[model samples]
Target chain A: MRSEIIITLVGMGIVTYLTRVLFIVGMKGDRLPPFVVRWLSYVPVAVLTAIICPMIAAPEKHLNLTYDNPYLVAGILTTIIAVATKNLVITVIGGMGVILLLKFLVG
Target chain B: MSGPTFDRRQIWKGFAESVPVMVSVFAFGLVYGVLAVQSGLTVLEAFLSCVIVLAGMSQFASLPLFAAGISPLTIIGTTFIINMRHLIMGASIAGKFTERGLFGKAAASYFLIDESFAMATAYAEKKKGGSVRDYMIGSGIAVFAAWNIGTILGALFGNFLGDPKEFGLDFAAAAAFIGLLVPQIRGKGDILVLLIAAALSVGAYLTFEGSWYILITGITASLAGALVTRDEK
Candidate 1:
């Protein structure tokens, strides 16, 4: 267990350093290829979907999910408000409210 | 050129924005704290992991696999691909702040995350000057502090929560991602790319039985998405 922690920690440290160093060395800040810049805008949205996939695919795996997943409900509500209002705080609060309401109703 | 040192003021503004970010990061930190211990890490290690990596999604993604004795190589590779967005983000911001010097860029990159990038980009697009930089500082410091504190608190009392399953922090990640994604989801090209990546990722998961292969398919899909979007330019 100790070896695992040490190894993971060191690996993490290296990854963090390398990630930053590669960009710094490449002087990636200079105007990117228009081809790449156009692509970059999509990266966040694309990567996010990638991250989202594993979670939705295995809802019952690590993080727990029940028949009534308030978090899920609140998330849907949050997405709606975020788009409609284009406000992060409003969306977050709305989601929190949804969750709180669900908790009260369910519990 | 005598420049007034506004360092103190900058620090203050940084602290101010950090407060709310602290709230969100701390909430996630609470989950990480408990989960790290459950994954065979000690309290000290768990708290420090937050301090060091400072990336919530990557940390959480790596945990369960870590517990199952996945190879460090796989962990590192998976996390790097998952976080490849950082390369794009850092690239975009670098164009604006290169004159700030190498050290400043490195320092800035350390705290770079989805929230910070979104905040910075929006601020720039709005043509706000100092507040853009100040907001980043504020959010970063706040997230850092809140994360550390949350880890310690979670480490101490996380077990008492009995099971986070009850609260369903599970949904928080997806919720957070959706909270960000749905706002930005636009155009048929965007929808098509997302669907391709989604389908391929799900297929990979079923066949490979792990999230590892999903990275390859996801990136390939993203490249294809970019190619299809090119003619529009």
Candidate 2:
């Protein structure tokens, strides 16, 4: 297990470093291709949504769309606050508060 | 020295802009630390993962896979795909580092996590009178420090404190991502892309394991956005 851990860490480090430095090393002073730039502009939203949605929809490792699901309830409440306020602290705090409160009342 | 150098004032401003992001990163990191240890990793292993990989979501996504005794190569592949977005992120900001040359860029890019990249790129776009590299470094350093500190604390004391999920600490990552994502939606195309991304993500999740869905759905959804917006211009 220790050996496996070392191997995984080393491999992950190399791969992550390569990605982080890919453009930095190769691009020099040139502008990125316009098409690439347009596509890249959407990457963040795509990736972030991809990360968030499944977790909310399946907090238990499977789909749970029921109204009683605390995560789903808090997730909707959080999404509304997130879009409305655009403040990180409020969204996180407000969302967590809702989740815990719902868990207390519902669970 | 001709252009804006790494002055104290600029560094201070950069640090100030980063405090909020750093707070969220710290929260996420603390949760990851606790969970990693609970997932059968040693404290030292968890700490090393933080210092080495430094990517939050991938780290969290891989913990369960690792504990399941999956192949190391497969885990590495999963991590790489989940982080491939960084290639685009690095490329987007590569122009700002032209003056710094290769070594300086190599140093700065090491700390180019999502928050630092967003903060730095937004600052650069404003054409502000400060060194973009310096601002990035400041924000990056704060995030790195907070992550490492949070990891250490959680790894050592997490088991004693009980499960992080009991208080909805499990929602930290999702909440942070939503907080980050909401600000990026600018137009109908972005909204369309986001919905497509969410749908594809959940669909892919049903068919896939780990974080492959994030990579596959994210890139595909971005392509959908590109196609949708192509006729606009």
Candidate 3:
């Protein structure tokens, strides 16, 4: 019970409810324009990429072209699995393996 | 009589799909609860975190932002950036709801998790006219239940987790993220966008100063990929 924490949670809950409920209550059977819809379709991938990519390879405070990068190894493995089999479980296993390998081998 | 709008069958379906994932996500909630509580969040706050956001990645991302003393404005902005993916998910689900009334379409939008979307789309592809409504409730039940249960467990028993370091629950966010992502890449649009976004987001993190950079790079890259295809098809 911190008052601030409770307040924050309430704020978070209201915002979340609005975001979710707005979609259900507002859109119903309606639609956005084709141009907007087309743009919207790409938003997920774009935002996700912007969010996660480089952090994998260059986690240091600064970027480098050096050889030691755990994310690069993980990325390569993840990509190969994704492309070859399109199997998520395999790719995750691959990433985990890379994570463990990096912990043991690189450090 | 026709089934009620929120029928028991659909609720049960939702419950079933959600419980298994709850097991996995529970570990994560434990991690979150311990950290958030230690950071001075109340149990109610921790519980509400899951109910409100209902997203692992965003909530995890938000934690460091809070700890770092980032402004609410910055936190909101970053979250909006991270979550812009839902806009695309919403758009993809848009046409699927064409047959639904405005209210029905609106309701469908709230339950747009990866599993729900995949299963519902599969159901739609298999059957004409589609079970968009049914699938939404069915899959949504699982996602919703899993999230709530995981959060509550984390709040109640988070201390018993002993050390998150030993169990590697920290990886839960990345692991769960990739797990959900891997299972969902079914088409060219999805693949291309995912690949580029992955690359660019990593790149941005390497070069830029903040987590927001990752979101920026990812959004730009995905938008580029999505533009490669035409809507007419």
Predicted model with the maximum TM-score: 2
Q: What local lDDT score does residue B48 receive in model 3, on the 0 to 100 scale?
A: 75
* lDDT of candidate 1 over B2-115, digit per residue (tens): 532234464466567556656767766775676676665678888777777777666766676676677777777666655666666666655554234555555666767667
For every model in order, what is the number of clashing pairs? 1, 0, 27
| lDDT tens digits by residue: candidate 2, B1-233 | 45434556665777888998878777667767766776678889988998899887678767766766777876787677667778777877887753565666787778888888999999999996577777887888888878888887777876675665775666755675677689889888789889999889998988886557777877799888987786332
**Higher-scoring candidate on lDDT, 1 or 3:** 1
Task: List candidate 3 segments past 4 Å from native.
Answer: A1-16, A28-30, A78-97, B1-46, B60-69, B82-112, B117-135, B151-176, B187-209
TM-score of chain B of each: 0.74, 0.71, 0.66
Q: Candidate 2: lDDT over CA atoms? A: 0.78
Pairs that clash in candidate 1: B14-B138
Which 10 residues in a row give candidate 1 chain B its minimum summed lDDT? B1-10
lDDT of 3: 0.57
- TM values, all candidates: 0.69, 0.75, 0.66
Q: What is the DockQ of each candidate?
A: 0.29, 0.53, 0.34
Clashing pairs for predicted structure model 2, backbone only:
none
Model 3 chain B poorest ten-residue lDDT run = B164-173
TM-score of 3: 0.66
RMSD of 3: 5.4
